[model samples]
Target: MWNYNFYIYITTNPTKTVLYVGVTNDLSRRIQEHTENKGNKNSFAGKYYCHNLIYYEHFNDINYAIEREKEIKKWSRKKKNLLIESFNPDWRFLNNEINQE
Candidate 1:
């Protein structure tokens, strides 16, 4: 049987003042699209330059990934920061890390 991979991810601006939560099957490609979308006023990620990957969670099911994304979206900034700090205390951009794997 074939396995499917999905992801719930968070991205932030360079100054880390803005956050965007989303779900995707292709994290790298999606991040790339976000990068390309930067400066486009119509997109929240683009408008805020929220292409710097900061946090992510993988799921085998798309529904689970979407659900988790929604949950994160509803979280307070402090809660989101705690979640990010749990695995990434420094809030380092994780694009390179995910691409290398």
Candidate 2:
């Protein structure tokens, strides 16, 4: 049997004013890319500076992670806020934490 890691994550700006939902197999690398892509006006995540990880969920199946990302992307901002708050009430940036663990 084989197992793989996939992540559906939510990241926000430093001000916590914007949200970006995405799925990736390498969470740390993905976050790094996001950080590097910051200030890239062509990218939604980059343009908004939504690189502060606030919440994430892991999955063994990539399909499930993609599905969850799409579902979250369709929700209203208010709904998304509630979802993030439920998992990360303080909306703390988790980029450093992920790497430390």
Candidate 3:
């Protein structure tokens, strides 16, 4: 459904050194939350400041999205980097584009 899509997304720190894998239905809001939560020790993404959107895959089902997210999280950095490069060759920051028309 266009109104509510599930997604498995990847976010990295400004330096692009740390990566965080997550699943969400509202991508724009989630990115905003991550940005607001940056540097909060209680959260992994926050603790590592991994709030810059780098890659994302859309899915119609939440279960499928979560499964993909879990699978990606178990992958090695090298593999994850390869995946991101496949979708985003330059690993560009995608945060600003999430809610854009």
Clashes of 3: 0
Alpha-carbon lDDT, every model: 0.93, 0.94, 0.94
Q: Candidate 3 residues 1-101, lDDT tens each?
A: 25558989999999999999999989999999999999999999999999999999998888889899999999999999999999999999999899683
Compute the lDDT of residue 12 as modeled in candidate 1.
97
**Which model, 1 or 2, shows the larger lDDT?**
2
Instruction: List ranges where model 3 is wrong by over 4 Å.
Output: 1-3
Q: Write candidate 1's Cα lDDT for 1-101 as tens digits.
A: 66999999999999999999999999999999999999999999999999999999999988888888888889999999999999789999999888887
**Model 3 lowest lDDT segment of ten:** 1-10
Per-residue CA lDDT of model 2 for 1-101, tens digit only, reads 78999999999999988899999999999999999999999999999999999999999998999999999999999999999999999888999998776
With candidate 3 superimposed using the best TM-score fit, by how many Å does residue 12's alpha carbon deviate from the native?
0.3
State the displacement of the C-alpha of residue 55, model 1, in Å, after optimal TM-score superposition.
0.3
